[model samples]
Target: MHRFTRILTRVVAPVGAVALAAAFTTASFSPAAADTAPAASGPAQNYLVLYKSGGSAAGASLAAIAQARGAVVQNYAQIGVAVVSSGASGFAARLQAADPSVDSAAATASFGVSLAGDAATDAADPVSPPTPAPGSDNLSGLQWDMNQIHAPEARSISGGSSSVVVGDIDTGLDFTHPDLAPNVDFSRSVSCLGGVPDQTPSAWMDDNGHGTHTAGTIAAAKNGIGIVGVAPNVKLAGIKAGDAAGFFFPEAVVCAFMWASTHGIQVTNNSYFADPWLFNCKNDPAQRAIWESERRAIRFAQQQGTTVVAALGNFADDLAHPTQDLQSPDNTTPVARDVTNACAVVPTEIPGVIGVTADGNKQFKSFYSNYGVGAANVMAPGGDSVLQRTAAAVNGRVLSTWPASRIGSCLRKVFDSGATYCYIQGTSMASPHVAGVAALVVSSGVTSPGAVAAQIMGTADPIACPDTAMYAFFPSVDNGAPQVCQGGTAYNSFSGNGQVNALRAIGG
Candidate 1:
């Protein structure tokens, strides 16, 4: 399994304002220290206490009493807290004794714990392999490559289009977008909040444009207005969990996952990061519950044979040096001397999810992509230049859908004035490329996320990245490193498995 390095921070707060408390006393802690506290003797016992909303008073009172009894409060959320006691015996009684307001408590012998292990010692320099010529435009043809190997290989393999449903668990989609309307699977696409049905047929409406572009990359209908998606035939189910500000809460994401699992969604694309300010969920009960819920949902998805694809975050730090970057993008002011890595790659790191990194033009890894050996299962074209246009001057760059809310915002002007299209760059963009391909693969009958990931990684063209001083820490061999940044042999960390060769991936 691959693991990205993360920075961990501790925020101790007063009982009255749990949210405000976290905002004030934020401090950095080492990953090991942040993740693990001394476990008590006997079996590791964990329990979740579900309290009524706004019942923090009751929850905190219970936590105080649990601390007195040498049981650590593992996490605290708005709804409840997850407590790990020293002894399994009589925990419910003790919890109830601590606070009678506890509505219900469920005990478990062990809770799933994710520990940052040692870095990969045997990781070698990248290797060079044969690569397709650039003009092949392998990255542009979304579903073609995936279908070549997994789905029925044909020019028009849209036969199972309606049967394959993809749920996008990202910023909301622009369901009304013209390019995406015809194929939008509105039946399954719905928002978790308010239990409202998706009114927009496209469900590709993005408040931040991130989700819309991602959705377009995955399964935008081939209406000839925008670029075709990898799984152009598949139906898309949009689940709007992220807020308008482009923020995704763990609870919301977990809820999206659970909803997707129950609603016949075969795959989901999660393109958000964890709170950059926090790391381990040990002290945060709400985060822990969300994490647990996400895992459970992922397990359920697997049982239902759904694939979950997630992006490795843009935090530019290594697993060994997870605390280096701590500056906020908006504020030059340093938030903390060091912070734990909370890249979006978490649930992906969990077994059964597909973790993706970004590369473009078959040569360089996206500068913002997070890279650790075994960390990312595959790579895809995320786009380098903001213009994302194949012909540069023609068509005024990429014609993908834009987030509905941001369509007229100042940021949207960068792409086109008064147009519901925007040009942005990040691994966030790259993830959907692989996701689109996965949908195509699923359409081709490859049902498992792991199997799709294996096919994508196994079939990619290997290239060596150029030895830019900025990427010095990235492993590169003499044979693989390209003389230029964009020109290299295949299979460097810079461009994992080379550019996602659709023709090769689909067995052309």
Candidate 2:
């Protein structure tokens, strides 16, 4: 029913897109073993100095930083923040005191945490399902996630348009993987880690497997080999933002958005909760820079025609009505603090971004997924290992492409046709299902972020809250906190507008 037909496979030429990479080194730390340092006194530490809005660009703050014995590394002039490296112990306060144009300066690591430490790869998903149908990929039977969202049925009508490029802004991707090679947009792909763009494929290759898995779910080729993606014919650009260890610095995230917007990336699948504090509090002066800088970058990307789809989180808390934050300041000594609605998870909770929660094949919200009334905008099959297990979903996990070289610790891994694959779960896996749907929508000529979002929500299938008693079994998942559901059946927190329907997304 859409205008454009499916596109043929072609390699997008490499385009040149940094290590401002040495600034936030976990090895270069103060003896405290904490991510924060009182003085820039040890090895140089990286800090993001936020300039007041409508003021001078990051360059204007450079002089003040240098006067405080710090040197400006990368300047995100668009967002008015400067990445500064200094060996002086008290550089941030001194820089702010020396410059009236500066709002606040905070250590980059103080606000960036690795989501789910294993790069979104979780254990407890070891069981493998029986072989798929004879003609399909040998492992297709394990793809209950594709079947749940009706992606294959949708693909019969549309596999997305190649012109609409979707960027997976996570760990670097494995472009050599057969499933991803055909649709890989080599030209638009770049690594923004360390706060700069490096277009070299080796620079952005998948040192960590998270990016490859997400990329596979979004746009793996329908090449009759590995599993086919939700939007198999669309282009996939791997924009590496998270490091191999999985730390996502705020500056790196900002650089990624700037790159995506400037390069015309239509959709970016961000399965991360940027910043070290799980819940960044606005009133807190220490966190304002991290909160505002990242928010503005996302807003700018949206303004420039990039639709961002993010995972709600794995915290299992009600994001809409937040109370206490048990896990925060993740890189340093974690102090359990009382939180209110004033605090929120980065990127996902940020305005205008599409927030997705995860559910298994049984249609129950994953016990590890974060949810709240009106918090998430949509839901997808992220897989739940405990409650949703079935014959097909042996361990109730989503299966996708994995790197052949990396000897990852994923409980179960599949070697198919000489390539490696694995089973994993998280809102991380759930987000791409919707991102792929968003790509399908974008392929239909709904290019604007707002219109693309509207199309995705309009086509989703709504679901009501499940029995509250179900939460009892998974109480141990999130520190024994009680999971509650709010809103009507048509629009609840757990399932959001509803599970995404790929066929409906493309008007099949």
Candidate 3:
């Protein structure tokens, strides 16, 4: 199986045991650390030179500086981020020294998939259940996740307005899928893979099925073909940030949010963590640039009326109390490193963004979903076959759209519909459900992003912690550590406001 497929299949270990490597020295960066070739060899790596806006003298225009040094391929004045390539040795350090306008200069690093990359093994020890029967919408029965969140009832109140757009900043969307074509807003979609926006719709096609799956869950049309989405009529914008190989570098992440901020997207679902580092430490000098750039973009999006929703991640660990990380810089060399409170996963841990944890069909936290007291803000059905199986929801995994070319074991080919669907699990699947509900709230006249978030949290069903004796982590294949749920019914690490109720989200 491909590494990307494995990522979608396995549950992330919270804090895998490994001896911490030596702390990264703050001395002059090496060629590899800077992600560039040696000055004597190939060209310099691309760098995101951040400029402090509204400063005295407008301090040495980045374009002029870059032209003087090398070539300026992209300029993102919206977020004060510009990408340039220069072969000069120690380019970032040298540029900072020469110009007082640059706030920070760091080489752009590639990020890997945040999910576990083990072979395609179901952690739940799944047993094949009966296929879902086609319901009123032809294939609605295949969508247990939608029914679990009461999407049908919510649809009756407000399926969603075409004017309200949900930006999916992942791999991209299969805009050609019949179920998605009716709701996809091609003009609003863009590929932000190189820290720059490419408005061509086909340029954003999803090679991996992750983005297509997420888009379907958000708004896969109510056109009576495949499964209906949580907000079946809302327009969905594909903000392609992750590439064909499933890597979401910082340049792409920063571009996606900045693109969303100005694009009139009411909400965006961020299912993958920003790449390279699993937990970007705020205090680490090396990781600070990556965190700051992404932070500004997210805050800017929120300020611009884009309600940002992100997954808490698939690692079955407490985000608030992480001790170690065994899988990091996953696109390159893997390392185990000691960490502390100063570190955090981006987008999800960022303030103002709604962080979501995953719940199974049984309404329990999915064995793989990450949770933390302050980290997770809400809960939704992501899926779990081990602890939450039902005859109706075969395999217990969330079913959504998949690209025909994208291969997976649990694929379902629709009869005469010319569309492919699949069953998969992860916090990646859970965040979109919340994104759909957020769209409903916006469609129902909640204009403010903050107000929409407040409404979702306030209207969610309150669920109390399970009895200690009854708390058991399923899937004996995993660590099987004793699971604990913190906080009361109204709010807890396991289930934020409780499970998200789509009907209540629209004031039903």
Candidate 4:
């Protein structure tokens, strides 16, 4: 299935064994080591030209791009990053040399991806679950994830306030779905596929179901239709950072963050990582530009009080103690490279952003969720089909809204009240749960991103790592390395601060 998850694909064997690959959308960019195109003018490729610190206004950089034969796709003057397009050969080298103001000119390759292209065959794995009764929001009973986090109980205290806005920075969301239509803030929604903001409704509509599913988990309306969200009354904005093919290029991601910060969005749920490289290693001169550009954007958003929450990826590897990247430049051929903690999974690993790990109904780390002592900030229900093989857990996957019109996009779908919903799994599914809780905290007057993060971590239900014997049955699918958990009970690699408690998040 074309799942929105970053997991280890068995297709490529790193060091002659199974290894890592993200299952969701991401892009490929090479700034420090640019491609040397032969001297022939061709269709333009977009480049993220980062200006030197304390550089002059965007006008100077814009002029430098022109002198180097690069057309301006966008100029983020606030953060000193610009998206420039050029057909000229060696455009990066020319741009860097053309402008003393430019710190780095990194080129995004022909990045088109079916992100996290997990070739695993789960399309027909289980029988479709029963549909919910009409007009009564009967699906609430099937929402095991909500109950796990006490969202229903929390709603009695605060279902979220209209003043708080949460943006899902993924594929655009389904604006017309009844469960989502009531809360979707179209004015704040925008598409950044072209590296600039386009607020038109059509520009940000969900084609791939990943964004739509994630939005439902965050702020689907509690208007007596389908399942309710953790922060149902909060306004939801669809920030389209990925293209129709589900590729999340640096230009689009940068634009999404800029929009979220500049607009009134108080929180953003990022379920995908920076692409091509599963772990963006700035230590590698070739990938530094991509990492720096995204890092600046994330930092800018944090500065603007936007609580950025991201997935810890689907690969069951430790982020705090990263060792190798076996599935990199995934859009192209796979390569295995030795890595260190200096390499990071974007957005999530970036300081100030809240990184989330996934847990099953049993409250153990999901079989596929990535975890690390310092990398993950919190945990939430993301479902685990393998370990949760019991009647109480149903199919062991999280359910949320899907575009009814794009029925084909969701491999397994449940039609309820003329709406389409689907059951899916991934750290991508888990990140939004924390985002929703963060919105609840924001609604309760915790406006600062730093405070919001602290409240979520502080209020979460602390969970200890499972007994070694309990998890021994499950080993890392990518490598034979034993799935190890480090750190203490209150704060550990597997569960972070622990399963996010919605009721506690709002001081209930």
Better of 1 and 4 by lDDT: 4
lDDT per residue for candidate 4 within 389-474, as digits (tens), equals 44656888888999987888666688788888988888888999999999888888788899999999999999998875555655
Candidate 2 off by > 4 Å:
1-40, 57-60, 110-136, 476-479
Put down candidate 3 lDDT per residue, 156-267, tens digits, no spaces.
Answer: 7678777788899999988888889898888788888766678777779988778998999998887778788888777899999988877787878887887787777879
Instruction: Show how many residue pairs clash in every candidate, following the order shown.
Output: 34, 11, 2, 9
Every candidate's lDDT: 0.49, 0.75, 0.74, 0.77
Q: What TM-score, over all chains together, does every model reach?
A: 0.62, 0.85, 0.86, 0.88
Task: Give me candidate 2's TM-score against the actual structure.
Answer: 0.85
lDDT of 4: 0.77
- What is candidate 2's lDDT per residue for 191-211, written digit by digit as tens? 777666778899899887888
Stretches of model 1 off by over 4 angstroms after superposition: 1-160, 193-205, 276-278, 281-290, 319-321, 324-345, 386-399, 403-405, 410-419, 470-493, 496-498
Off by over 4 Å in 3: 1-10, 13-41, 53-70, 110-135, 408-416, 467-482
Better candidate by TM-score, 3 or 4:
4
| Tens digits of per-residue lDDT for model 1, 378-472 | 66655444222334222212234575566564243333223355544456666676676666566666666678777777776665655466544
Better by TM-score, candidate 3 or 2:
3
